[model samples]
Target: MTTSPPLIISVSGIRGIVGASFTDDTVRRFAHAFATELPMNARILLARDTRPSGENFAAVAIKALAEAGCHVFDLGVCATPAAKLMVLELQAHAALILTASHNPADWNGMKLVRADGIFLDAAAGRRVESAYHRSKRRTGDGRVESVARDDVESRLLRRILDVVDVDAIRAAHLRVAVDPCNGTGALFLPRLFEALAVSAHFIHDTPDGQFAHEPEPIAENLVDLSRAVTEAGCQVGFATDPDADRVALVGETGQPLGEDLTLALAVQVVTERRKGPVVTTLSTSQVVTDAATANGCPVILTPVGEVHVVDAMVAEGAVIGGEGNGGVILTDVDPGRDAAVGIALILESLARNGRPLTELAAALPQYSIEKRKVSCSEQDLQRALDGLVQRYPEALRHPVQDGVKLYMEGTFQCPWIHLRPSNTEPVVRIIAECEQRQDAVELCAVAEGLLRGE
Candidate 1:
């Protein structure tokens, strides 16, 4: 038996700070739990970002998989999407990615992938968690030393190029700047841009597990990337978190565009080309609907999280879908949140339209989204959500398994508030978006207060 680290075990997976909350034993136990979910002689894909602890965790994972009688395909230091793609290609029974995503450099975690190349849905995630609690251990002789594939980058780019207008983008010869924040994206984004013939200036491109700035690609953390775009004389700038699953872009003239534009632009591109349903999360911006409506396509709203969005997209056969956090999931190419796919789609949108990213974004509906993060115990997270519902009795609630989202009545706008527990941390994420920024901020503040019992 091992002492459990101070970890946040949610549907997204297990997350904890390295050397403290994420200890070696926790890694072994979680790996064991994940391996228990696999069948005998199952093949598993294992990968990670550039976090310093990644190799150590991967080592632990290899041993656990080997002991569980599973053949492991170790894709060392690859993007989250790349790991999932390999799972689909290998017909593996399951996959695991060691990445804390946008969390700080000190944090590390795991993302469990199913055989379908998607993260396990809520039910399956719960089963894995249950297996963890039950100490489900499988003993068998697997392999000790595993071979790690090096072609994950090229394989991922192949899918992107196939879905996008490769030639047009190459012809455009657009200049772009990117900040991968010293994570796994540094391994492939530059190469992908070079393959597309797009001139790219990469900052923090070294895969040393050292973050140059805050890992989240939000506006506040992208000042340097925005400046780099201007200094490099680039048309746009790009930023990706550690795992490179989400991408935030900077428009021309070195201005930070909201992360929402990534999905909005991708939605616009797809809906204009194909008239179909657009699936997105409840927490996403209304720009999705605006883009969808312009092309005579309806928008379908699902719960927050990549799996839920992908599940909805696959079930509905939606042409495009993703989250507002700069995640773009093109079902034709991939059904997961992928920054690489988003970049390709956005670049294609730029190339086909012969317009700037700024102009393309300006053409969309203008809405303000205010987000607040509050650290809370799991009990308090639920209590706050319950309080919000009690406060607004007449509000319409959305059906999302992870969080509580309510459309409240207001004079000018019916603000929607999505209150959900963080998938990666011990915090509650309160997001409110509306046509007016002030309204959204106020709603977010009110929700945060309710959650805090103020």
Candidate 2:
């Protein structure tokens, strides 16, 4: 039998195509590695999204953790953020979430979290990689167990209620529409709204692996959500990816707020309540920075990944952080990217301000961001970065920590252009932010041209 391609491991987590790079053996190996790295007799939480293959992989992971002599808490069919919440709620030493967020349905992988409920940073991830390569062995009579279904949702709800004003949300008498995109969000969001006493209209809320539309919450893929917001005549609409860790929103006007606004709005809410530093990835829109500045808060930019963002948040003592892709992290609630937390925060902001979602979003700085990916061999990336630096010497400011980000001074109405190579995929991502859509388009075109050595 042919061996599957090596799993793609990183600071964020490990992911690969199910049958190809991510196989049963690979899952076991990684799980064992994680088990070995965790403290002795430590309790570990295992959760997965609604992927068809997740149960099988989760089973393998449970066994591996048990064999490595750790108590396993099986939280079947939970959102990635829910898993993070469980880790903190149970005070488990670690968590393993089986999901491939925004990737195709056929893909599934594991996201490992530490005791603090944050994705492992590069240093921690490297330790796991080292342990995997060393093939460390531990012997114990540990066993795997399942969490009671009756306890799951209630426990999650309690954590959520602690941070959000459930009473205020219910008093607002909000009618909201939720689209889970056939992911794990379907499992918790409905119950969350019910507990808040808010009327919720659900679409694709079934926790099935089958996806009704593309799992990404990008504007182009959110046509159904936009229409649902209008058809349901709800005050607002919310959508999440397969894992439900990321979220996107639609206004009462049935207009998509775009994913970037999700984080910006959430940040605004958090800063308004308690001003502090915020964190986001480099590829995020300038609107987030503008919002932070307006709130008299500074924004720290990290590389593009949840791990990087979380690390920065911890380091900076940020009160709020997230990526522009609709993933919001509230340190007041949890340090992980939590869609549920984000939704509650947004609703609370609406309740406090007594404004429609559209008007609230419109109040933020407006900037158009365009993202494009180009196929390029790994060998060509260095040359491309070199070329970018040489070509835009005067206009370029390189923060080589992540992928190369180019700051074009006064070139466009917006601040900077970031061109970063994908760590897991064989493509370089070009992200340009500007006040004008045409300017963003032109920036992407120019960056793509330069990266391709045109």
Candidate 3:
């Protein structure tokens, strides 16, 4: 999964090895394809993460968009969510963020965002893909514009501040530790903390793209971050990928709280003050269900990916929705998954509750989540799913949606196994969550058995 040099195109976006699959030609062609759909004189927002190959790819994209007769607004070294907010705040026609997110340092990609601060939906994604193959460039020229970096950070931070209580957070005098993975998050997190007047001890705070560790912010990769939380005497620790869209947390006890808690904790903050439905994907943790239900809010489960979660929130009028991978989509601020907003919500939750983050996290119903993956072709994954359905006839099968989601609700206590092919990679992801750790692990074993033709 580390820079395999295989180009992957999905609803998630386009990702590949920097020089191999994701080349100058790839960026130019994709940008041209995206530009073909835009009207002349359209103001386009362009941003990139701190990846080594990001600037080169961004130049290719800027050239393509400019050649297409669109006004290009370049906000250098900006997080994915910040760029998304810039699109809506500046009223840009569209936006392109050059980031592979948690992908390896050698890998790079582009996330095409709409003007409303959300990623492209299925229909729009197809249009961009079709344009890439068509390779048609609109005949004309436009100029590139530059935005002040301070201005860029302020706009997104203001949106999050508007939705959260700054006075409450400042009064808590909470000290927090943050690990931005030396990505664009460093450009955003510090400023937001300063605005909230929260005490933050920041590590890996440079944006040079030299990641201090594995960039995913998972528990295994966050041991250093976990240690820093207790070492710094902070209430909580936060980690973000290069783009800062997804955020994982570490508790005051020097424990990795897992990425799922990011959304669950944010839901605790948002729903306590405001009332609205909660939205998330099938891969999200069961803790979210417990939190939402306890608050008298219904949960809408969508397919994997933040775009689907955002779409469901828009349709259902949900206040907050995001993927389980440390993404919190606050619809009130921007539809994108913003770690900046996640930070605000977490601080506000601690401030309002007058409790440590450890207690706040423990207050949520505990659940065990086991995540595993199998490297196989898509057809092979489907074959395994079919075999699984044949073996477990009692399970409810959902075939037409994202993947094979087998629900075991009536007999089991909210236990489910969702076996879905990875849209961004050539593999099948097996996610199982339940009230017990053994039950979650057993569910994964069931999928593994099916994959092994047991």
Whose lDDT is greatest here? Answer: 3
Pairwise TM-score winner, candidates 1 and 3: 3
lDDT of 3 by residue, 1-454 (tens): 6645478888889998877898999999999899888898889999999997888888989998999998999998888888888888898889988989998888889899887888898899999999898887786778998999989877787788899888998888889999999998888788888888888999998889999898998999998888899899999999998999888889899988868999998987888777889998888888887788788888888899888989889999998888899999987787789888887888888889998778898888888889998877666777888887777788776443877777676342367888987866657899988888899899899888778666
State which candidate, 1 or 3, has the greater lDDT. Answer: 3
- TM-score winner between candidates 2 and 3: 3
Give me the overall lDDT of model 1. Answer: 0.84
| RMSD in angstroms between candidate 1 and the native structure over all alpha carbons | 2.7
In terms of lDDT, the poorest run of 10 residues in model 2 is 407-416
> Cα lDDT of model 3 overall?
0.86
> Which sections of candidate 3 miss by over 4 Å?
1-5, 398-400, 411-413
Model 1 TM-score?
A: 0.95
lDDT of 2: 0.83
Report the lDDT tens digits of candidate 2 across residue range 1-454: 9644346777658878898888898788888888888877789999988899998998898888888889999988888887787788889999989998887787778898999988887888888888877776586777777887558778767777887777788889889888899998888888888887878888887789899988988888788888888998998899999988888999998888878999998888778767789999888888888888888998888889888888788888998899998999876566688889888878887877889999998898888888899987665667777777777777756453776787778342265778777755546888888778998899888778876778
Q: lDDT of each model, Cα atoms only?
A: 0.84, 0.83, 0.86
What's the CA RMSD of model 3 in angstroms?
1.8
Clashing pairs in 2: none
